[model samples]
Target: MTKHKCFLGLAILATLVATPAQAEEVSRKAADLMAQNSNSTDSVDQNSNNTQPPNTPLSPSLPSEPLYGGSDTASKLPASNYWYVSGSVGSASPGNDVQGSSIFNNKLNFALDSTSSWNIAGGYQRGNYRSELEISYSSFDVNNASIDTQSFPFSGNVSTTSILGNTYWDIPTGSKFRPYLGVGIGAGILSGKIKYQGQEADLGTGSSFAYQGKVGLEYELARKGNAFVEFKYLGIGKYQNDAGRDVTPPNSYGVNVGYRLGF
Candidate 1:
């Protein structure tokens, strides 16, 4: 019976010790589970904060290049060329002597103001300098009697045509306007018919050298084109007869208006 009682005591002691050990093991496991859950939640929160939108990317920014200043971007702008047509009235003047009847000899003088005549022309130009080739035609009659002869009208018709080549240097003075000066050299053909004693006589007919000097202002009408007003002193030098006789020629001062098509 004592042996049995000893065995019972030992068995009861062992049961109590085992129960405490099992409870401690369960507590340690619970703590480890809580730690693992805490680590998982922190990872989820960090991932949500660190993410980027679908459209955004990681890269460095770049700078833009300027258009003005020494950059060639401004130089790439278009170039311009110009063309035009103009018209005006002008007068002829006495240049040299003619030989014929006493009243008809070397007698031509400047056309009367009433003898003003009309002309037409066309031209072309490029950049700051321009060149033009033109053809002009005019016909007018003048009656000038020597102060000595208060009696009769020195009546006749003088017709002239010219082909000229002109060049200009255009100076820019404003954003919308420019001033220009030019010179022209040309050849002129003059034909004179005199009505004397009810008979028509051809006095002088030939080609002569001519020239002009001009000044003008041009106002831009389009971004690449302009309108201009010009004043010129034109000299159509002396005409000579087929027989080498010199006759009156044309010299006139006039103003003209025209357009230029810029390049």
Candidate 2:
């Protein structure tokens, strides 16, 4: 009985020792499994972070193209077919003569008295010179200085008609203004009797040669025409009397405002 009891005790001791060893082995295996699972989770998280792409901003679209539309017609106009008329109201005065040999200096006095005159003219422009033809009419009051038998003072009226050919050399300054110098030669008819010292002097109807020189400025009012204001010195040569006496002719000068058209 004693031996059997001893054998049972030994069996119980072996059972306790084997149970502790198996439990220890089970705990080590579970700890290794947990460490491996944690390492696998860390690898998965690192791969996910490394493989992520950077964000990109969206770009705006380009603007649309501009449309173009129109016609072309600006260089087709005629420029040189124009005509003009001119009128002026001004005075006529004589010049100074120191030597006193100027017969028409102060010997004859003419009063325009702000009278108005008209001229019809046409022009053809070529390069920088304009050629013109003019027909004009003017009137003046003439006073003769020579006394009569009683030595009384007198004055008379005269009407002069002229037809002239003129040429002007133009100096163009810019787009709007041009200053010019011009000359003209013409034939004129002088009429009406003169009163010398209150007596009628028989100055017959006669034809006289006439000339004009001018300097003026013109402003372009149209595409091919200009409005002008000018100062002119006009000369009418001497006349012949009935007894072949060389009588004094009309020597006048005045300011003229006029227009010129191009052709």
Candidate 3:
């Protein structure tokens, strides 16, 4: 009976010791599982922050090349070619020694008086060059005449109308003023009347080749307008009068003032 009692006591002691050891092992395993779960959650949060979108830019980008061939400012410059119209009025002085033949077959010479002249023109201007079509008119009075060296006061007048094609070269002065040289070739019609020693005569209308030369100074008044003063020389070929006499028209010199407008 005593041995059985002892055995029962030993069994009770062994169960108590094994129960505490198993409880310690279970507590350690629970701590390892909690630590693993916390590490996994932290890794997921780090990945989300790295994958977020990047920041936006502050300004737009610009182009590298120019819009035109020459330079950036070339496309904004004004035009160099244009069309223009002009008009002028001036005084004309004819050459003194105008020679012709009288109906009585006598050699005659005339001295002409200063007269008024006018012109209108339309043209195209390209940079320093210009081309134009012009119409002009003038009238001269005879101051005196000589029949083979015997001089006499004369009463007569001659008028001319001309159409010309003209060209000019403008010199650049880097200012508002420009100097120009011009030449023209064309046709003229001459017509008039004469009364000498109480004998009335008609100098019949006739057409002849004509030419002119010019030198001028131009002042710019605005972007599309200018004023000018010029000196001109005009000449015409010979033609016949009503009396069937060949008449040589005199060459003329003129000083003109004018204005030009551009389109």
Report lDDT (CA) for all predictions: 0.63, 0.60, 0.81
lDDT of 2 at 93: 48
lDDT (10s digit) by residue, model 1, range 1-263? 45445545655555577687775665565556666766888999998997787777587577866543311232332224546656555543433322223343443433432244555566755566778776666665656434333334556766767788988898855355778999989998888776756877675689889888889888766554567787777677766676566765656566666665533
The total number of steric clashes, by the backbone 3 Å criterion, in model 3 comes to: 0
Task: State candidate 3's TM-score.
Answer: 0.69
lDDT of 2: 0.60
Q: Is candidate 2 or candidate 3 better by TM-score?
A: 3
TM-score of each: 0.59, 0.56, 0.69
Winner on lDDT between 2 and 3 is 3
Winning model by TM-score = 3
Runs in model 1 deviating more than 4 A are 1-79, 82-111, 114-122, 147-151, 223-225, 261-263
> Model 3: runs farther than 4 Å from truth?
1-79
Candidate that would win on lDDT: 3
Taking the tens digit of each residue's C-alpha lDDT, what string does model 2 give over 134-163? 776666664433322222245666666778
Clashing pairs in 3: none
* Candidate 1: pairs in clash: 79-263, 80-263, 81-262, 81-263, 82-261
